[model samples]
Target: KLKDAHCAILVVKMKRTLIMFSFILLQLLLGNSLSPKHSSPKPNAEVTVMGFVYCDVCSNNSFTRHSYFMSGVEVRIVCRFKAASSRTNEMITFSANRTTNEFGLYKVAITSLDCADVDSLASSCQAKILSTTRNEKLVDRL
Candidate 1:
């Protein structure tokens, strides 16, 4: 009789523990993540992004630092993300190029984000260099 009572008490304790654990899990999953720590901001929700492009003219020269603003380079907005299970990251790219004014200044308005990619748009927006008009060659010395 004592053994049966002990078993019943153990069962009751187990049931309460399971119920408490479930409630905690529900709160964590359903609660709004207002904390900045959990929030990955969808930044600069603007359609337009602007920047400059430069050529490392001295890419091969270790001792010299020489770079020039590239006038006709293609600058782009690129986004890369990968799921833990996926073999490779899916890259989404958007570009609208313009010939830089004499100053090597270029302004680009992202035309790619619309009905299809509105959600992931701001989260993955990044500026990148696409290509340059001048053929890149190894310069041995200045």
Candidate 2:
């Protein structure tokens, strides 16, 4: 009788362990399936193009110790992206105007579904200075 009770206790423990393992496995599967999918950027994702406007005090076409960042400078950003697939000859152009902040930083946030990544923007994007609050004229260095 003692041997039978020992075997029955072992069987109960085994059943409990199996039930716990199955419950854990089910929870893991459900967690993975219920999670949100974000393999790529959303349709309304915002891409920011930011840069700083600085004056080349030395006029050697490079930033030096005498150079300073200029504030309240108007910058125009233009980005052209080709269609993802070559089947369509569609060229999407995004243009925006932004003014430099106190830190001489200008930012243009573009919300578009056409822009896939920043790599595309780096190849075909251009930024030009439209105007500045200062008396000096601004030139495109990059």
lDDT of each: 0.55, 0.77
Q: Which residue pairs show collisions in model 2?
A: none
- Residue range 1-142, candidate 1, lDDT tens digits: 9999999999999999999999998888767464346556546433555555555566753434576665765555554333223454554555454545565666655543432344555565565555666786322110
Q: After superposition, how far is residue 60 of candidate 1 from its true place, in Å?
A: 7.2
Give the poorly placed runs of model 1, Cα more than 4 Å off: 1-45, 60-65, 76-94, 110-123, 126-131, 137-142
Q: Give TM-scores for every candidate, taking all chains together and pairing residue i with residue i.
A: 0.35, 0.62
Tell me the tens digit of each residue's lDDT in model 2 across 45-86.
Answer: 567778888887677777778888888888888888775655
Q: How displaced is residue 71 in candidate 1, in Å?
A: 0.9
Give one clash count per candidate, in the order shown. Answer: 0, 0
What's the CA RMSD for each of the models? 13.3, 4.7
